[model samples]
Target: MEETISIKDIFKTLKKRWKLIMLLTLIAALISGSISYFLLTPVYQSSTQILVNQKQSKNQLDSTQIQSNIDMINTYSVIIKSPAILEKVIDVLELSQSVDQLSQKITITSQENSQVFSLMVQDSNPLRAVEIANAVSGTFQKEIKDIMNVDNVSILAKAELKENPTPVKPNPLMNIAIAVVIGLMAGIGLAFLLEYMDNTIKDEKDIETILDLPLLGAIQKISKVHNKG
Candidate 1:
């Protein structure tokens, strides 16, 4: 005979080990919160936008020129992160980081079929992120004029400092929530595992299930009488 467990049995198991589950959950939450708040370093991001427009006379403006500008925007995005631009930024800012390190912190992205692109920078300091973003945009604009011989690049927007800028990573609330869920799942799994591994006959139900027979009766233990003999 095969035996099947019901939802009630699962509920009973969980209730029996509720204390252990709660304890694990609390422990996980504490560890996650600590790592999020103290161990992980927060990174701040700042971004600036630049507009790429061809310097053409009113009579020279046409669809071909606009399409060409849009196509060139892709190349411009690549050039903005190149060492040619980053080296100048480093020298101007007097930053100790190398070109490769600064390049990793810089990001250039443009919208599909758009003439404007944005440069974003990330750093541990919010002010430094803003400075890097603005400096990269300015340096790229000046260099693009010399490299491409096009004086059409213009600064659309400069990065501004915020009074209370928010860090982009190390979200404590989200981390804690995830940890709690994982901890609860682990605890539930362990409880079921231990229950499955246990093979003790504690009651009439166990006997009936194992022997595949109806429970006849149960005998109660009584104290043995002792006489001074």
Candidate 2:
């Protein structure tokens, strides 16, 4: 037989399972908050900007020279992550990580048609991240002169340690909000599924709907009581 649902039925199901829905939402929010606040490690990011300043013989900037400098930024980005630059930075900083491992935390970014590029590093320690960023940029600035036989790299800004630092990931409020939404959806779906699967007759309405029978009357049971005199 085909089953039809009404708004009233939907409301009835939700009302019946309100406790389950509330419990699931609360649990999800609590777990998400707990993981975000306690379980996950906070990562701090620091960045230093380097400029590709190619000296021109003329006072005004040359278009061809500017384009060449911009194009070379791509090469510089890769070179910054390479062992040629990272090895020196690691050795200078006395970092325990390998070139590949250190490279994973470093990101090189440059804007289109802009000579300035940023060297970003993320670490659990904010001061360490700053130190790594400055070290990598400084090493790249010094080594590029030897590797490419050009002295065009200049440190525009060095990464500085902040008085108070904040992590970029594992936002507890956002995580909890998302978890609450997912939990509500899951709880509602489960509630309807359970309601659909239950076959036991509970009331006169269920009997009438499932059995297709008219109830003349319902039998009432009388309770016996004993009195002592």
Candidate 3:
């Protein structure tokens, strides 16, 4: 005959192993918190915005020119991260990192059909991140004028140092929360696995199920009687 488990059985199993589950959950949370706070290095990010427009004397912009500027944003994004621009930035800032290394720290993004693009830099030092972001934008603006002969690239916003900048990575609370969930799942799975592996009979019901026989009766345990003095 096929056997089916009830909700009571699940609750019983959980109740029996709740201590182990709680232990594992606490251990996981501690480990995650430790890693987030002590092991992982904090990374700070700063961003600079650049505006792309045609240097024209006209008071109004033509739709064609606007679309052309929008299309050029992609090319500009690539050029901003290129060695041609990044090399100049490194030279100006005298950064210890190479062009490739600096490029890895930089990110270029723009809104769809927008003329403004943002350059973000991430570093361990918030001030360094801000400096790198601003330097990249300034260098790109100067280099683009020489390379593409386009004087339209202008620094819309420069990165500035903040009094208390926040790190972008190693979020301890979120990490601990995720770890707790994983620990709970793992602990519950292990509990069920241990229960499944155990073969010894615990009660009359287990004996009846294993032997395929009806339980007639159960014996009561006897305790030692104390002699009166």
Candidate 4:
């Protein structure tokens, strides 16, 4: 005969083994929390925005010139992070770091079909990240003008100290919460699977049904087996 599990059976199993599930969940949460707190490195980020303005219009009413300027700004964004730009940034800051080191910390991105450019910098130090971001943006604006012979770049926004810049990496509470949920699900699944696969007789009813016989004597298992020598 085929056996089936119902919601009632699931509820019974959970009721019977809730303690085990809770314990596993707590353990997982604690492990996750500890790892996040001790083993994770914190990263801070800052961003500055620059606007791409049309330096001039050969014909002040030329839409084509405006489009060309926007396209050039996109290309300039890529060049902003190139070694040439980063080298200048490092030199001006007098930062005791290599060009490659500066490059690692800075990123330049632009929105599609938009005139805004974003300079983002990440570092272990929050204040230093903001400083690097601002310095890179300022350096790019000045250098790009000279290189492209255009004067349309303008600072839209500067990175500011976050009164409450919540650290963006290694969220211990969130990690622990997720770990706890996963552990509870895994424990419950394992418990139900073990219960379903268990075919050994556990009660007198099971023995009677298996043997198709009348009730017989019952005995309890002893802590230690006795030898019949």
Top model by TM-score, which number?
Answer: 3
- Backbone clashes per model, in order? 0, 0, 0, 0
Which residue runs does candidate 1 get wrong by more than 4 Å?
1-5, 59-61, 221-229
Provide the lowest-lDDT 10-residue window in model 4.
1-10
Q: Model 4: clashing residue pairs? A: none
Q: TM-score of predicted model 3?
A: 0.96
lDDT of 1 at 68: 88
**Residue 210 lDDT in candidate 3:** 100
Write down the worst ten-residue block by lDDT for model 1.
1-10
Q: Encode model 2's per-residue lDDT on 45-153: one tens digit a residue.
A: 9999999988777799788888888999999999999999999988999999999999999998888789998889999999999999999998888889999999889
Model 3 lDDT on a 0 to 1 scale = 0.90
Q: Candidate 3, which ten residues in sequence have the lowest lDDT sum?
A: 1-10
User: TM-score, each model?
Assistant: 0.89, 0.89, 0.96, 0.77
Candidate with best lDDT = 2
Candidate 4 C-alpha lDDT tens digits along 1-229: 1234467777878888888888888899989998998988878899999888776635465677667767987688677888778888777777888877878877777777777878888887788888888888888888887787878789999998797776667789899989999999988987788788888997997789789998869888779878998
- How far is 182's C-alpha from truth in model 4 (Å)? 1.7
lDDT of all predictions = 0.91, 0.91, 0.90, 0.82
Runs in model 2 with CA error above 4 Å?
A: 1-5, 213-229
Q: How close is candidate 1 to the true structure, as a TM-score?
A: 0.89
How many residue pairs of model 4 clash at the backbone? Answer: 0
